[model samples]
Target: MTGIAGVLAWIEEHLGIDAAKGGLADAVLRHVKERCAELRVSPQSFLALVERDTTEQEGLVRVVSVGHTWFMRDREQLELVVGRFAGRGPGAPVRIWVAGCATGEEAYSIVLLADARGIPVRVLATDLNERSLSFGARARYGAWTVRGLTAPEREKLATPSGLFEIPERLKSLVTFQRHNLVDPPPRGATGFDAIVCRNVLLYFTKPRALDALRRMRSVLAPGGAIVTAASDVLADGTPSSDSELPRALAKSPTAPPTPVVADLTPPAPWGAEPAPPTKAADAAPVSDAAPREAPAEDGHGAVERARSALDRGDVDEARDLLKAALERDPLSIEGYVLHGIACDASGNTYAAMASFRSALVLDPSLWIAELYLGLGHDRLGAKGDARRCLARGLELHAKAPGLASLSSATQAMLAEGRAHLVEAAAAKLASL
Candidate 1:
């Protein structure tokens, strides 16, 4: 028969709850024993039953999972949200998701703050515990849960009926539902303007936490923000590597638009002969099509200038030039690739990833795009994605016999790409 350790592992796998953590073992043990007693079976048998019966597993999860939270638990985070939304026009649509919203206090707090500031927003509050969600939907809170609020805020938010009850006006702004953070997000939950999942990742193992954070990121709109507890940081205030929140937000969904490369001259037809020079520059006749040709030539020239600037370590100038190049020829694969390189040099890995991905979209066979993309994901602590991209790049690199014929610069890039992949693998192994 299996022992307590076996049962704990089962709980961790099924619920994504690290039962071995402080006090969690006691809580999970108590629930296991309770189930054993009710089922008239031994602990092992109860575990077997839990595995076989989906309802029993869920019941165990509900009993052991924490739902102990109050409104405005992190005032700083709330203030950040308010500050961001304060000046937005009234007609602007704001959507937020409060993941792991235990008993709904956090969800309601967001709505109240937004309403007080005259920001209209819709909040989707989700928890794994149905009982907690039901209580949240009722919008009723005991005195203890309402302790942090100012008297005026409390008075404005709730009507006291034995326990304080949230008014319909505030409650209507939030919708509560049951959700599992480790699983795929529900349909219609994507494209949120913001997602608040503070103080929740601590419950799971690092891998599971990383998975959950990625799921949250998948649903967030481009440039959307995520808030997490300051305690998730290290002594230096940098987020802990084990904590996925910082890594996930590093590549924010709402990245800036792809920069267009500046125009320098009109586009010329391929292999067209240059016009003969005149004694006076103005003596040349102005064709009706000169305006159109000017932009394309200018774009090509800007791309060349950007590459030169990049070679000179002038990332800012390179970026400016590439912006104009892309603006002139949005489909220019070389422009996007060079822009990605500039972004990487500037330490903007997120923007670099976006730029590289855009290049790949334009030309999937671009040799170095996957390499840089993998490196970007590696920096973000998305090891799985990083490994996948690197592997694909390496595979393509292996099949290309023309590497020997490429320019010295291209050959150097291939060497650098391989080094990055090797370093990433080493880092992953060291962590393990």
Candidate 2:
């Protein structure tokens, strides 16, 4: 890890932000370079200073992270919470926790809606970014943040001082705190009626995310549930009321799952694990067996064991298992994909690309392989390959519904859209 890669890793560590997602890698590199020029220091020196200085780390993270949220961002979810409260007799004020409450819009929005229905509420809003917490604490915002509300609604809720300021009544109902979801919950952070953690967990690594979800679950009152973005697919056990949320968590390309002793869920994404290899060519017996009671690599369960290794953060094991799996099932496209993900995880760029290339050799039009190859190429500064692969990926998944049809591993890697990845590729194209 050095240069751009090292800095991106640092950002992911300190800020708990996925620097690789949604063109964030390019953004971080550009920001660091510009900051280096402004500060009159080399990139290496700047990173060193940031490593030791808490203030610098916070400042750098503030500039690089994205929290593009607004009031009533998901109105349906809010309504669901408010309606639940209205049904209950007066006992305790509805205690709502707005985890990752960016800029406080969502927090304040909760209060305003509850008030409309004459339900009392108290809200605790938290985020990892200090800058965002500071902004939320101000209780003021630009008009663009309130675009969801009509003019009459906006006027009723905010004071116009060239900026939309929430009235003190609403502001007093909410408290803003700086918090990293990866860490344990703030002391005594418990007994919440609702937890609105939307569009936030998608960036977290699997282990860190599960930890956060566990903490959030501890704070929930009886019958209280978490409302998350549709895209977030949490691991099994922790429950949420959001019907749109996926039942099982999938792998994020960069962050594999933490080790679990017993994982009963099918090891494939959204219950769509690849079928047993059909061709006689694919029936080649597994040459090398993995540790423990796991079956040989050629078996269907080989993918399952590899997925298990990923859960344990043992990419080396995963890579080996995938290798034997692919060897046994030469025509298995998903085998090649899993192999590529494991190779990428182990930082073997050449082997990773080969795995993806092998998939392409099998089927030139495979969107999963082409898309990841482009993302991996962009990260390693292969601009030409990134541009070509991403263009094809974006064209293949142009339809909204098709995105969901991809395997779990592919979906997890694609935290955002092909367009987002393509824009980063385009940036590299311009640089070239």
Candidate 3:
């Protein structure tokens, strides 16, 4: 491996951050050298680019934090924002925050999405590093960063020269600031309706991630959601709950799953054999029972009944039957997946996520379950979880058609779901 790859590996191992191959590390090194020349960075300072901050100048930690953010990054999330806030009679000014907004893709993407719904928005876009923040304030992007938007979305939201010329109308909606996640958000910054911080948190240890999540929670307004890269989650380590809380986890774009052998779940009856590891006495209990659902008479029969109802356009009936099946056999992966799909069709998004979770517990390799999980999270406006589920599902499913065995009606719905997710992910990246 070259020096850059070595650095990439170090970053991944230490920070769990994805560093691009090729000369990206070289580019980051060069940028850091040029930017830190005044401070006379030593080898230690160069390496400190990836370290956690302890001093007041922590925001200056350098390393080109180019996220894979494109325009309109999560189209579905944007759609929800537009339709719910803008499509409805607009009243209160929508307050949004885009944290770790490297080069402004996420911030700009929100602008594009909000514009589509005709909802006026105010965004506070911030980053720890000044270099990335500078680019965000400029809002100029090249082709790679502009990939997600439809021609019209691009034209309407972007300047002719590809710079986002902040419109006076929208200017009141957005403010650029610098804030570090390691520390409290600057005193003046508090309370937001939604937060978009995509593809930037693979950079810290678990403790650091947890700290960032707590701080995010502190700033979020009631009913507000937080967004992250597809694979990232709230470092808060809190098990998700159904009770409405001040903060909730959002689904990010779906990324690939980790290697099968590396998965935390036990291996399936037929997949790869895993090496046994010694467990501590206090290790968390592994529930072999598939996330405990209600009992079913016959798993296969339940699937068929749900499928028939779905085919006949009885969406509500299908949902109800699927739920019944899950109640009958909580460990039934098929039942859980079908239930999730049905719930989505019936618009009970959170329940759909629970169903998907049950299914994932029963069968971690069920790519279809992951896809459903993504859709459910997206519907709940949990973009971060949605992105992770989708990305991991894509990794597991690869070229597999998740709805291949379903009837045309069901297939159509599945296809629509997939398309929406893909477009949403594309859009989320565009603003990066």
Candidate 4:
């Protein structure tokens, strides 16, 4: 039998939990089988030794139990927490807990953020596995864990080995311990300002999940909030309410709000006179035309400016100008679209999606807007939307040569996007 089947059988026997009942262990085990090979566990061979229940079995299980987390795991949630608690002044050495802190990425990130803000935070980082704790205590990290850090943050926080060097001055501010959330947390581990268990509790049964949450709540200060992965934090069983301190914070709504009516309309084309204003109800909606600024002097002219900056590889400058143009006039659909382009160039896919979505909301009939939105969605791993948008853009382009002709650079992007969606869809289907 495959190691996954063996694991399922072994878990059912020892934990007295049935995989047939659809427990967290079942999901975790499946993910473990898929990813185990990367982590160096031979899933196929591991299955053969299930009856042994030896040290290797425990080792295999621990590897499966530990989770993968990174700095800024949920980027928006990190921003919110930093804004809420760490932004506060040196107040009684603000306490925080990171449960199931495997490999210490999230815990270390919390430390870095708190220190950067000069908050007096005492962090208690814990995990159930001794080996995982040892790895964390060593403070060495891989490149992937440090991917999100800004250069300054990296310089100030992490050692050359990629671990945050716990400076003596801040040594008292953080502690690491090995504790299982399945048991009561160690004495004094509770009653903190915030508890971050993002992506961890999704591995437990509902009863286990509730118990762990209650433990998190028992020690949480009246207003303290628990942050979990967006996948696990649901409205049906959420811990936060409208007015109380949250036991858990649900994912913030990410969809754009309904578009508000505006007085503005797109500028008339180059040499034509201004079109007479039609009544609001009778006016034909504007296409994706943008607000025009008198072209900046001493630079490549308007049409070439964004392209020139992109060509010269001055990405930050391009992004800044695009952002400024958008802010100066929110009606600038071109500005919004280009800002999304700049964000994608700079490797901020999430921010790019937000920008693209904003552009489409301003002018839904815009094929370029739809095209770029599809590209952004594809890059962010949304294949279905990407395919639909690309097909839609092609349809519009067929109707009008002006609509169809993409810049060579954008054409290359479209090609790459198409390739990625096809590959992703195929892999997903094969897995099923």
lDDT of 4 by residue, 225-278 (tens): 666544342224453211232322323455212111111222221122112221
lDDT of 3 by residue, 289-388 (tens): 1122424557567667777876654455677667677666676666676677655543344456677788778667767777667644543346787778
Candidate 2, poorest ten consecutive residues by summed lDDT = 279-288
Between the candidate structures 1 and 2, which one is better when assessed by TM-score?
Answer: 2
Q: What is the lDDT of candidate 2?
A: 0.60
Task: Give candidate 1's total backbone clashes.
Answer: 25
**Which residue pairs in candidate 4 collide?**
191-219
Q: How would you order the candidates by TM-score, starting with the best?
A: 2, 1, 4, 3
Worst 10 residues of 1 by lDDT: 281-290
Q: Give me the runs in candidate 1 sitting further than 4 Å from their true place.
A: 1-3, 158-160, 233-432
User: Which ranges of candidate 4 are over 4 A from the true structure?
Assistant: 1-54, 86-91, 158-172, 233-432
RMSD (CA, Å), candidate 1 to true, equals: 26.8
The root-mean-square deviation over C-alpha atoms between each candidate and the true structure, in angstroms, is: 26.8, 16.4, 18.1, 21.1
What lDDT tens digits, residue by residue, belong to model 2 across residues 223-339? Answer: 666766543543342322223332232123244332211112211111211122121110000011122243453545676677677655466577777777766778777667778
Model 4: ten consecutive residues of lowest lDDT: 279-288
